[model samples]
Target chain A: MTTPRNALVPGGAADQGPASTTPSGDSRRLIYGHPSLLAERPTHYCPGCGHGIIHRLIAELLDELHLGPTTIGVASVGCSVFAYDYLGIDFVESPHGRAPAVATGVRRTRPDAFVFTYQGDGDLAAIGTAEIIHAAARGERISVVFVNNGIYGMTGGQMAPTTLLGQHTTSSPEGRDSSLAGYPIPITEMLALLPGVSYAARGSIADPSQIGKTKVMLRRAFEDQLGGGRTSIVEILSTCPVGWGMTPQESMDHVANEVVGVYPLGVLVDRRAAAAKGA
Target chain B: MTAVAERPRLMKGNEAMADAAIEAGCDAYFGYPITPQAELLERMARRMPELGRVFVQAESEVGAINMALGAAATGAKVLVSTSSPGMSLMAEAMSYMAGSELPIVLINVMRGGPGLGSIGPSQSDYFQATKGHGHGDYRVPVLAPSSISEAVALVADSFELAARYRTPVILLADGIQGQAMEPVMPTFRMPDWDTASWELTGADGREPRVVKSLHLRPEDLEVHNAHLQAKFATITEREVRWAGEQLEDAEVVVVAYGTAARVARTAIERARADGLHVGLFRPITLWPFPSKALAELAPRLRAIVVVELSAGQMVEDVRLAVERVPVFFHGRTGGMVPTPSEVVDRLRVAWALTAPTP
Candidate 1:
């Protein structure tokens, strides 16, 4: 796709142009903000942070699925607690690690509404381990968007549950030692073992093509829930440039290189598709 | 006048409260199984699905309370019940629910406990319930019901009070009340308020709604605290309720609440039959404490006797309310309940001590 000439214009001016005949005798179309984004102001994320890309993809999916009117999102603690502010949908902020439990309530009460939770690695893999495990075990028809940056970005680059072995974080200055810190938890794989979970996938946002793949995984997760499948989870390997003490380009390189080796990408489980194939 | 129900049926206090929650059109119930209160959860599990409402036996008390908080944020009439130790586990989420100002109803079927003391009845959580059970400068309107019928009525009223103030309300009962069966006329009605105006449905064509309790800035937190305080003041003024019996000509009055109040009532009657001028003042709303009414009656009474199932937890409040009048406490704890005769004996001693020298 060719980039628009006025792409850098603020407030998405390039996408606000009217349909007109191009010099090549083709009709031109403009694309503005995603229907579900409240892009009235800039985000609070650091420069080169992966949250912006992830948030945009979620907004686009909400628009594509037309779930804005009936979707209830649960925002977990950490960097994404303010997701409700940027996403043009109703939300309830859960305490650290409680988003799964909260989403369980919302989904159970409003079965007709699409419910999802946006959580970071620390929020889901640490304090909230029980909540997510039980919610999945109960087969709650909710989608979970897990962003694994391998560090506690909001709390200033501390080690997270998904921190890679030998990774240098503020809390693990000498790099994480398996003997002391144990190994990084592969939560998606663990959840996939549960019969209640209908779909589980891990993707990366390190490159444009990878980001596109991540969006596809998220869309499939949401579709599974919409089709009355049990719990669906899409764990996207993200980046935290400031927290990782690296440039944006270097951080993406790290996710593509280091994180991908420790936490492999691809669909861990897809019960519906597997069943169809079996039949 | 509201129309009366066709016929009263016999029900346990726990089941009566659960039935009342359904009649009041509760949208969801999330709770764990705990002794004395397990029947409430059992009833909800069976009935909520039948009525097309939601019910979940949460993995833990913490999960249950948080789930209720989440449902409440969506403007659903939510309820969660637990016993002493279970209530302790739910305190953190309860504080968050209060801070968020989301309306919810919590039923605590009192059991003996400093730490799982006993499954038997005790009022040890009086201080915890009335004096900011969780952590904060906030208060929950607590209604203590003495009988099964009153439990049903209070449970029904709790939903309305919660919605009216957008705050948590507690329907406090004891193990005795939870286990004992009595005749109750369950009345069903929808709440007389609009929940959609504040509840989170969806953004749709309007601004999105965010329900949260985190006030990071000091200034913003101060404002939130002030707003909560104002709401509490209004509730205290408008919602104080109690049953004052035979106080018109009594010289000695017994102040009690919940199951203890039933014993106090019998004690007062026994004293009255013996030609003793004793009355009973039973508080229904514990947080408001019926301070004004107690103070007004303090000047005329010679002594105020506080009867309780704990070691005099509520006597402190009685002392604060009736400064000049002498206050005496007679109680039991550790799953033990004081007999009516014991309360009458304490009343006599209090009366004798306060008698004027002639």
Candidate 2:
């Protein structure tokens, strides 16, 4: 509906234009087809890291939601440092742990525009803890793609806030001993109980089917943000193969089996009923 | 026109800066209230909404600066003002803006700091101002003005430079300069804004443009850095500005910048009255810090006295410009401004020391 006249290929199929009357026709394929927001460049995420899959799913969701060009992606520092390189939309590279604050500015200024922060565990849960908490507490109408891989990836496998108990990392070389390091942070569960967040869920890209399902959940979060609900976060149980010293498949299995046991996946807070009643 | 004369008056430097920001078409101002510059935030809060702009006190210095940087992405002339510690907190955003080349205006009403140094005047950030504090090889342009009038003029120019060069532009002034009320000509100039071709805001009908700093390949980052260096080189060519005082039959030249420069005027008179044959070279722009003008004075003078509020930071630049031609320096550290008499005393010592040197 927001398409300009000249965007269409000249003299091609009129059915292949944005003005297509049907949402389920060839014109719909033309309108909602192609990867409009995924960068043409190859991702540099280490193998088995689920960042690549999450990036693709987010782009696909944006295309489906018809919010690609208008969506401003805040790419936080960490493994997703090159996220700007992979996202074809307008991307603002955020300071470490400052993505939520930056996203708040974007959403508040451009209320009609779709704004989201793509952050890693260290960025969202550590130094950026206050930022994420305050933005969530303020009920900023922004979405966050929180990729929690259980261990810090980009910075030589340091102990992140999400580092699971008994997990061996560069910082916790003897493995995250519970008595020494304390328990893993159940971020989504903790945030979902808060009043500000409208939606909070945990999902993973352990397999292709789960990847497909995660896309649907991400779409819901984005829709919730667009529909004037409070802020939301979809925590992706990502894999860090290089840091974990395992193959990508093994890492995916690790997330599906080991990681999800600690960080359970479910909609912790659903404000749909509240939103609908208010409306 | 009858109503024009009846309009309200009595504005401070911070108030003038806010008015200039509004006139320059800045759509958003995100800042925290720090004394000597608090009125800037207050004025914005009052005026931004009436002019159909946005103003918000960000959670912290870090939050405010990042918010301004975000506003820059949508092609807004976003600005943020801060004191020393606050600017130090914003060090990361300064580097981000410099590297990403998003046009932003960062005003530093500098206070004392080697830590939470003081709430009073200091030029300790001279090193930080010229040197991009966070990370990277780019220098954010530093505009040092001596008065409120220059603060307003330089702000408009800062936005223009940020857009034209795609970098963060700093309007560096100390607390005294920020707090003092000076007569400013309320003149406004409208910059020709054609968003039809900016890299951000989707570039509309133009070729796709990228606004980022990540270059994985060595060759790519190297090329980007070289291109930026060349741009700064061009900036040096066109933007080296300063105010020169008497040099006819003079053997001593006092070098200063910003408020220190204005203070040197009185010291220069005192020194000349005492028959020391002294003059002044006041730097208007600090990063491109009047190297050519100072270098030109090296051979003619027996010595150059670099005066500042810090422990001789600008002296290094003078030495770089003049190349060890009996360079004498006088400065005070930790939130203390060098009084005119202190500067005069330094000049006397400099002339006496260098007079007997060769």
Candidate 3:
């Protein structure tokens, strides 16, 4: 449970190594440890889990947007249920699948405050489907970060609503039969169809380049909410190595190949661009 | 009392509660339409947006309650209204709110139940309201208003009590009380309480606050339950409220609440006119039960008669309070409410059975 090496420290990179005197002999130099917006504690997520990366991206965006002091995050039930413990911002924990509705409340009540919901695949597509759809349909001015790992990570690789047709989960050890388990739902595509959704995009963190792309999508989603856009959401294809019974590298390779093939990555909808083009 | 301009207006019980909530400075209202309580949501839809407050006709009762819970976490005053079935759907979130110790007001305009029984008036929810509606060793302060005026007052008071105790408060009215019209002064007064210390309003350079009910450790959960129990005990001690009419020298006391209390009052009046020693004891706070007051008044009366719309749900509480005094129950279930004449006849029979030999 050691802290991530990339955790941001107060000073810059120079503070971590031996102090280098810049002729004038100024002592203190900035270095890295953890982001200012992220808490200085080790997360309980397993090795190779994408949650840490997602958390870092969110914290980075929050810091970049200068929204740390004015942001309220709603945490959904799942592995990331303790996202509040990792983010140094105000948060409210909602019951399974209710984070979107909760975020709606916060967004409507405090329009000036940046509100967002951090949700997982099962939490967003199953029990909470109605909440997310209604929130989008209402054009609620809140940002949502949906992490799709294709399985219930915290609950030990159980079948999730977004689990692939032939995916093997604890509940579907026989390799999910379509007649029994049904097909994987494309929640991002469905949400993008709602007129109330100003932006809906899908990205992945399977590799360095994908992670960078996902971060851009995340920043854009947050910016959309800040710009008074309604119901912006970013669906990130995440990896759950422990749940998938694979090494962290193997999970990353799987996400890059199989997962990306199944769930294509890119901007599914961009209402602002569409509106400008129409005008 | 602080002086304010009084504007009397005739309004239904549901609308009165909505008006009172808005007048009390409720910042948001999230609700799903349900019979007997739809007017409350309608009123909110009409008024909340005009006042620049938040109003959402949620997709479901479950969504509405959770929305209110979310708003409450942000230190915003919130209200959610529903009927029996809707309340049942919201029970999960209500329990979560109580466990989290989030202050929010929930108005349950009860109707016949046990399962979508009917849309008519019924107090079957008395047990559900006074006892914990959701799982856990927590109790939300339940207020029963017998009249439209009391409904308005109690709806306003619900917010104050909820904020003071940091707990959910239920304004348990009935279909009749919700649908019936009565004149009331549309007075508004914001609660004199501050939530800045705990409410999750952006942390703002301070320590981040989390509004949640997740205690992983057994020992920690036990401690949390103990702390909640202490708060509930204080509320039980300080917030038990009721009304006693003509109980000084009464031979029999009629106990009731909500719409049934009004019927009992009429019954008491008719019995008194007939030269009978009958009085009415109406509980304003169903949860705290006003049991102590009833216990104090028990020894003076020969017997106690409990009148309710349900099949004697609250009679058990009455009996629990007045153990020595013989308690009798007269109830009409499945949407049938007993009239004054029927109640008076029942009271006469009860008086004969328990009154001293003469």
The CA lDDT of each predicted structure is 0.88, 0.80, 0.89
Please give, for residues A18-56, the per-residue lDDT of candidate 2 as tens digits.
666665554444443335566655577776678888988
Name the runs in model 1 displaced over 4 angstroms. Answer: A1-26, A29-36, B1-3, B187-189
lDDT (10s digit) by residue, model 3, range B1-358: 2224467788888888998888888999999999989999999999999999999999999899999989999889999999999998888888889998899999999999779899899999998998878888889999998888788778778989999999999999999988999887666566755688888889786888898998888999999999999999999999999999998779899999988989998899999998889999999999889999999999888889999999989999998898788888899987788899889998998888986776
Chain A TM-score, cand. 1 = 0.91
Candidate 2 lDDT tens digits, B1-358 = 0112233345588888888878888878999888668988999999998887878787788888888877776677788898888888999888877777778888999888788778888888999999767888888789998888778778788888878877788999888887888767766454544333543443223333445667778999999889989989988888888887887877888888888887898999988888889888888889888889888878888888888889878788888887768888888878788899988988888887776644
In model 3, the Cα lDDT at residue A141 comes to 93
The better candidate by lDDT, 2 or 3, is 3
Q: Report, for all candidates in order, the number of backbone clashes.
A: 0, 1, 12
lDDT at A167, model 1 = 90
TM-score of chain B of 3: 0.97
Task: Quote the lDDT for A198 in model 3.
Answer: 95
After superposition, which runs of candidate 3 have C-alpha atoms over 4 Å from their true positions? A1-33, A277-279, B1-8, B185-188
lDDT of 3 at B238: 97
Choose 1 or 3, whichever is better by TM-score: 3
Predicted model with the maximum TM-score:
3
